[model samples]
Target: MTFKHSIKTALGGLHSNTSRSILTILGIVIGITAIMLVLSLGAGAQNLILSQIQGMGSKTIVTVPGRQPSGPSDFANVFLDSLKERDLQSIRNKANVPFAEDVMPVVFGSVRLSYQNETYQSTVLGGGSAESNNVMSDIFDIYPEQGSFFTASDVLSKASVAVIGDKIREKLFGDIDPIGKKVRVKDKTFQVIGVLGRKGQVSFFNFDDMILVPYTTAGQYLLGRKYFDRIIVSAVSEETIRTTVNDIEMTLRANHGITDPEKDDFFVETQADLADRLKTITTALTLFLSGVAGISLFVGGVGIMNIMLVSVTERTREIGLRKAVGATNSDILTQFLFEAVLLTSLGGLIGITLGSSLSFIISFIISKFALASWSFSFPYLGAGLGLLVSAFVGLVFGLYPARKASQKAPIDALRYE
Candidate 1:
């Protein structure tokens, strides 16, 4: 028989066993669906993370007061008391860090904010100098919508002035003009000077839920710590990021009297470094989950093989009649192989469609409810790979059944009950 006729015979055979064929492909459909979902979500997560990290500009560097975290369990080391005022000052010195364009010491704490009877728990960020106000404004890409930022005098005098987020304004002030109002923080009351515009999240920090104050005041009064939690530095240009990092590290090491790099207490992370680390983590997680989902495909392949074997046995009398009527063994093998491949390939296509539709729906829900930045990405590569894998599985598993069906003697197959 011709190849076309072989394929036609294969379709007729599958159509006769429609229920069994559908059941056989179910595992393949599920496996491909899971893989597609993982790949699509993984791509979206990576994009969001990289975008957030790079949004701050490639020239940005963060100096934290602890050894570099190697894993999740070492996160507590990030809060270690290492970066002090002297380290901040040294980083700011032009001679010590020539490439450093801007440097600010950041100290933050969660505190209770009160305006008369209304009270809310909010995070307070402290940092900014006469020179650093515009610097922060540039770095965070935020400006006050209603009022103005505090003056240089505020940082120097440790003044009780506060700049609240837009959300804070809505909750506490309710349409009332927040500027020039007094908000209490513990025993200290700060006069509201400015309200940041509706900037939701900047470089992983949510500006909409935070309050900004002077670092000196926060260090002495709010957090009651003299050391800075983090020191932010920006380079003059993207090309100078490495130079600035090296300079900041050398300056801090000198201030701390450390000669060995491995023994250093603090860690410095540039924008590129952070992005690479996060990308690696995301990619690794994606691969791990994808591997787990792959187990289902193996099970699906086994199901297909078993079903095909059973199909050969059930069609034994037909196979004998065909072989007796001019059908060659090669033709019989091609027909059975085609049946297996068509079943798996059809399953792959259905799986791709279902997986993509589900992925899009999930992405929409996540973007609407959880993270506004989350987005959907079609996994074209994954779809292609899934299809290829499915075809390969069919080819490999179908070979044994096809060979068994082809090797049957015409008289013996006819005699089988």
Candidate 2:
């Protein structure tokens, strides 16, 4: 028989057992859907992180207190009090770090902000100097929508002036003007001088939900700690990032009296480094989930193999009749193999459709509810891989059954039930 005739006969055989065919392909459908969903979500998460990192610009460098965390056990280093005011001052000296364009110390803590009867718990960010305003404006593109940022005098006087985020402003003041109003932070009333424009999360920090204050004020009055959590530095140019990082390392080491690089209390990271780290983390997670999802495909393949074996047994007489009438072994093998491939291919297509629809619905719901950063993505690569894997599974698992069907002698098959 011709290849087309074999395919036609195989399709007819599947149609004759419609219920069984549907049941047999269900496993494949589930496996493909899981794989496609994992790939789509992974891609969306990676893109969100990369975009956030790119938004910060390439010239930015961050000096974080504590030893660089290398493993799960090293996470305790994050809470260490390593960076001090002396390290900030040493990095600020242009004579020592001429490549540094701007330096801003950051300290953050969760605190309650109250305006009369309304109270909200939110993260409070403290900026070390007036230059921090410019740093935030330039690197993070933060700008005041209603009023201007606090001036240099505000930082020097350890002023109780504050800049509120968009969400914070809405929750506290509603439609009323926030400028010149007072908000209570840690028993201290701070005059609202500025309201920031809508800036979403960056590097997992939700700017929209945070309030900004002077670092001196936070250290002295709120957190009551003199050490800084982190120091942000912008290079004079993108080309100067390495030099500035080196300068910062040298200055910080000297100030902290550290002789060995490995023994240094702080770790410096560039924007590129941060992007790479995030990408690595996301990629690892994607790979691990994909591996777990792959097990379903294996189960589906086994299901296909078992179903094909049953099909061969049930259609033994039909196969014998076809062989008795001039059909070759190759023809019988092709017919059975085509049926198996068709089953899985159709299942893969259905799975792709279902997975894509579900991914879109999830992304839409998350965006509507103002959840974490998420985007709907078409899993093109996942679909392609799924299709190829389905075809491969059909070939591998269907081979034994197809060969067994082809090898049965016509007289023996006919004599059997």
Candidate 3:
């Protein structure tokens, strides 16, 4: 038979069992959709994280205190112990530290802030110096909209001043200017020295939603804790970044005591390092999701086989009549097997279209709100490849039933109910 004739005959056979064909296709559709959605989400999240890291400034370095081990599974509780007041002074004074510009220890945690009748929960960051402006600019890249960042004098005097994130500004002050207005952190009141420029969400972290205050004030008044959770340092120039990071690591390792790498208390990472790691993690997650989604294709193929078997039984008399009319055994087998492959291939096409559409919708949402570059909708090659596999599966599993139909005795089949 010509290819066109084979396709026409296969399609007619499919239509004869519309409800069964529809049910079988549903399985493939679900499997493909799950695979597409998971891969898109993983890719979107990876892009979001990298963009946030890059925005922190290309050459910047961030050192966070690793979790102090209390025991296994309590790993999340570990954070850098306070860099002692004297140690912080020493770091600030290190002259050979390339660029030797600014070193600020930041204390951050969840807290409540209140202004007049308005109250809100917010993340509070307490650390500021003239050098802090450079570090913050490079990392968060947010500048003051009004007033100014806290001064060196402010850090020295432990001034009661704060730089508010845009979210807190909107919540507390609304249309009114927030600079110079007093807001309470925990219980003590501090004047808002500046309002930070609007920065949209980055890497799942929202810069527009935090509050910055003098580290000394935070140590003395709000938390009454001497230790800092994290420390941020800024270099004078791009050329000084690598040397500065090396010097800072050596200084910290010495201060922490042991020379062994395993005993080291802190982790020093650059933005580029972080982006690479995130990419690897997202790739793994995407593959895992795709594997899980492929399960539905197997189930769909099985449904096709079962339905084909039933079709063969129902058309026994027809098979016999065809044989009597000079149709060869191969022709009878080809007709039934062709029906199965056509059903699966059509389902595969529909699945590919729907799955791609869902991925694009999710990608659109991620780009719009997450400040990441938008990605164009692309066909999932895996899904298309999976369709071909599904067709093969139908061809293989449908053969046995088709051959059994071809073997039926003409007289016996014609006499059956």
Pairs that collide in candidate 3 are: 67-78, 68-78
| Candidate 1: segments with Cα more than 4 A from true spot | 71-79
lDDT of 1 by residue, 103-217 (tens): 8888998999999888989999987864655766766667889787766678888888888999899889898999999999878999998999887776777888999998888
Cα lDDT of candidate 3 equals 0.74
Candidate 2 stretches with Cα past 4 Å from truth are 76-79, 128-133, 371-373
In model 3, which runs have C-alpha deviations exceeding 4 angstroms?
A: 67-79, 82-102, 130-133, 233-247, 325-333, 359-379, 392-415
Candidate 1 lDDT score at position 128: 84
Backbone clashes in model 2, listed as residue pairs: none
Reference-based lDDT, residue 373, model 1:
86
lDDT of each: 0.88, 0.85, 0.74
The residue-by-residue lDDT of candidate 2 on 332-363, one tens digit each, is 99999999888988888888888888888877
